[model samples]
Target chain A: MGDFDFSIIAANWRFLAEGLRYTVQVTLTAMVGGILLGTLLALMRLASLWPLRWLAAAYINFFRSVPLVQVILAVYLILPLLLQFLTGRLIPIGADNSAYFTFTIFEAAYYAEIIRSGIQSIPRGQVAAGYALGFTYSQTMRLVVLPQAFRNMLPVLLTQTIVLFQDVSLVYAIGATDFFGAADKITQRDLRPVEMYTTVAVVYFVLCFALSRLVKYLQSRIAIIR
Target chain B: MNYHWDWLFFFQEADDGLMYYQWVLSGLGWTVAVSLTSLAIALLLGSAFGVLRTTPNRWLIAIGDTYVDVFRNIPLIVQLFLWFFVLPELVPRDIGLWMKQDLPYFVTAVIGLGLFTGARIAEQVKAGINSLSRGQRFAGLALGFTEWQTYRYVRLPMAYRIVLPALTSEAMNVYKNSAVTYSVGILELYFQYKQIIEKTSQVLEITIVITLAYFVVAFATNRLFAWIEQRSRVPGMIAGGQGGK
Candidate 1:
C-alpha cells in the first residue's frame, strides 16, 4: 500500500486514453456490424420460408443460449483455421482477428434476439392494416411495420448497447488491449491491483452512467412521439 | 492426418481403467448447486428490493434506485473481481483478514453472481408490480387485509405471474452468467475445460463437449421455466383471450 503512488496515474493518463480509443472504436464497429447482421437474422426469422425460419431459429437459440465468453473464445480459436482454408490465404484478419470478430459476432447474436422481440411486441393489427391497404408482405414490413417496431425497440437497443460496451472488456481475454486490458498490464507491472482496478471501474461507471441517461432521455422523446 | 479411434484411451486408465469421470460429474454438481443457490438469493433479495422500491418512504426508494444503478451499470466481470478481490480488503480489519483468508473461491463466486443478478431481478419485479391494476390493491384493502398482507397475498402473487416471462429469462441468464466466475479460478466447467485443453491439445473435442453441456443446461432450464409459466399463467390471459388462431 505504501509503495503505491497516485503520481503514476498522472503520468500514465495518455496511455490509458490511447487504450480507451481502441476500446471505444472496437465497441462502435461491433455495434454497427452486429446490428446489421442481427436485423438480417430477425427478418429471416420473421419470413414465411421454412428453411430460412429453421436456420434463423437455430442460430438465435444456439448463440443466445451459449455464454458470450465462450463464443468469443471459440471464434478467436477457430475462425483463423476456417477462414484461411476458405480464402486460401493467411489473411491479416486472423492475426489481430481477436479484436474485430469477438465483439461483432457476440454482439450480433444478442442484438438478433433484441430485434426479434421488438418486432414481436408490435401490435398484430398494424400488419393487418398494411395488408388491407393492398401492400405486399415485404412492402408492408418495409413501409408500415418496421418503423413503429424500431421505435419500440429503441430503449432495448440502448440497453443492449450498454451491455455490449461493457462486454468489450472481454476482448482482453483473447489478447486485445482494451481498457481493462490496459489496466491489467499496469496492475501486473506495478503490483497495485486495487488502485488499477478501481481506476478501471471508475471509467466504466462514468461511461455506463452517461449511456443510461441518454437512454432515459430517448425514452421520453419516444413516448412523446407515441 | 487420420484421427485415431484409440484417442478415447486418454480418458481411461492405462491398465486397470478407472475413468476419472467423477471429477467432471462433481464439477457439474457444483455448477448446478451454485446456480440454484444464486437463483434463490437473487429471488429473495430481488423481491425485497422490488417491494422497497415501491414503498412510500422516499429514502428506501432512493436506496433501491442506487442499488439497481450501481449493480446494473458495471460489467459482471468487473463486479466479480471487485467482490472476490477488493471487497475483502474493504471489510473491517479483523473480519476482512479472516474473509480474505477463509472464504473459498466457490462461495465467493456464488455470492457475487447472486448479488449481481439479484439487482436485475429487482427491476423486473418492480416493473411487474407497477403494471398491476390499482383496483386489485383497493379490493385487497376492502377485504380487511393489512398493507403487508395486501402485498404478500394480493399484489405479489399476481405480479409474480405477470413477470413470469421476464423472471424466467433472468433466471436463465443468471445460470449463464455464473460461468463468468471461472475468471476467478472457480473450477466450473469452463475453467476445468481450459485446463484439460491446455494439457491434451484436444481443443476441438473438449470445446464440443463444453458447448453441448451448456446447451443441455440451457434447454432444461427453458423447459422448466416454460412449465412454471404454464402453471402460473392467469386463467384468461393466454393468447390475449382469442384462442384457436
Candidate 2:
C-alpha cells in the first residue's frame, strides 16, 4: 500500500545482526549434532542385533511422527528436570540452549532416515568386498561403506540443512530471539509489522534459496552414472 | 523436582462447561480441517505449476520457478504473519478492509500454509514428471494426442505413480507444517497445548498429550499413503523409494 522503507531495518541493524548470528549458530550446531546422532541411529537401525534395530526404529518413528513444535516445547520444559535428576543439581537452562538441544535431537530422526537410505543405496557388493578384504564390521562401515554413502547423500543432507535453517525460526515459540523472534520484537517496538515481517521473510528466502542452489550444484556434481 | 503429575486434569470442567479434553479435541478438529483444506490447495496448484514447469514454454517455466523460489524459501511462520497482517493492507482498500475484519483466521491460515507447501509440492510434482522417460511423452504425441491430452493420458498417470512415495512424504510434511498456523491465532492442536499449559500449569502432561495426538495424525497419514503406494504400484515402474522430510 505504501513505498517500502529499509531505514527502519538499518536503524535496528545490530539487533538484526545478532539475530542472524544466533540463527546461523543454532543451525550449524544442530546440523553437526543432528548428523552425528543420526549416523549413530542409522547404524543402530541397520545393526545385526534385533534389539538395537528396534530401539533405533522406535526413536526415529516417535520423533518423526510428532510435530517439532511439540518437541521444542517438551524439551524446553522437560530438559531442566531431566538434568536435575541426572546430576542431582538444578541447572537453569535458557530457551536458546533448549532450542539447540531440541533441534539436534528432533532433526536427528530425519537425518537418520536419509542416512539409512544412503547406506542402503550402496551396492551390497561393497560390503562383501570389505569383508573379503578382511575388514572388521565397524571398519567396513567406517572406512568403506560410509565414504561412498556420504557422497551419495551429500545433496540430501544439505537440503535438509536448508530446512533446518527455516525451522530455526520455530525457536521463537519458546521465546528465543532468533531471526524471526527478533523481527517480531521490532514489529512490536516500531509499529512497523509489515516492514519487519517482510524484511525477515526476504532474508530467509535469500538464505534458503542460496542453499538450495548449492544442493542442486552438488547433486549435479555427484550424480552417479547408472 | 517435586512437581506432581495430574493425569486426570483433562477431565476437569472449565468455566465454559467443557472439559479440557473437549478443548483439545476441538483444536484437533481445526488442525485436521486446516491441514486437509490447505493440502487440497497445495496439490491442485502445485500440479498446475509443476506441469507448466515441464512444458516447452520458457515463460511458463519462469513463472513456475518464481512461484517456487519465492514461496519455498520464506518460512511458513513469516508467511502466516504476512497473510494475517500484511496481505490485507496490500489489496484494494474495500477488499482489504473486508479481509482484515471479516475473513476468518482459519481461511487465512489455509492460504498461508497452502501457498508455502504448494511451492514445495510444485518441485516434487516437477521432479515426478521429469523422472519419466522422454519416450513416453513422444509416444503420446506420436499417437496423435494433443499436448494437454498427451499429458493427461500418458505422462501424468505414469508420473503420479512413480512419485507416490515422494507425494506421500509431501502429504505428511503438509500436515506437520500446519502446526505453524498456531502463530496466526488459529486454535490448532499446538495452540490448545499452549492454552492448557497456561491454565493448569501442566506443561509436561499437556506436551505429552499433544505430542501423542500429532504422532497419531502423522502415523495415520503415513499408513494411508503407504497403502496407496502399495495398491498403485506398477510392476515394471521403479518406486521412488521412501524418505524425504
TM-score of each model, paired residue for residue: 0.90, 0.95
User: lDDT for every model?
Assistant: 0.77, 0.88
Best by TM-score: 2
iRMSD for each candidate structure, in the order shown: 2.4, 1.5
Q: What interface root-mean-square deviation (Å) does model 2 yield?
A: 1.5
Backbone clash pairs for candidate 1 read none
Q: Using DockQ as the measure, which candidate wins?
A: 2
Candidate 2 lDDT at B236 equals: 65
Report the error of model 2 at residue B175, Å: 1.9
Question: Which residue runs of candidate 2 sit more than 4 Å off their true CA positions?
Answer: A224-226, B230-245
lDDT of 1 by residue, B1-245 (tens): 22223446246542224442444455567667778888998999899999889877899999988888888888888888888666666667798788778878878888888889889999998998888888888899999998789899999998887777788788788767877777887777666565555555555666677788878777787778778777666677752222211
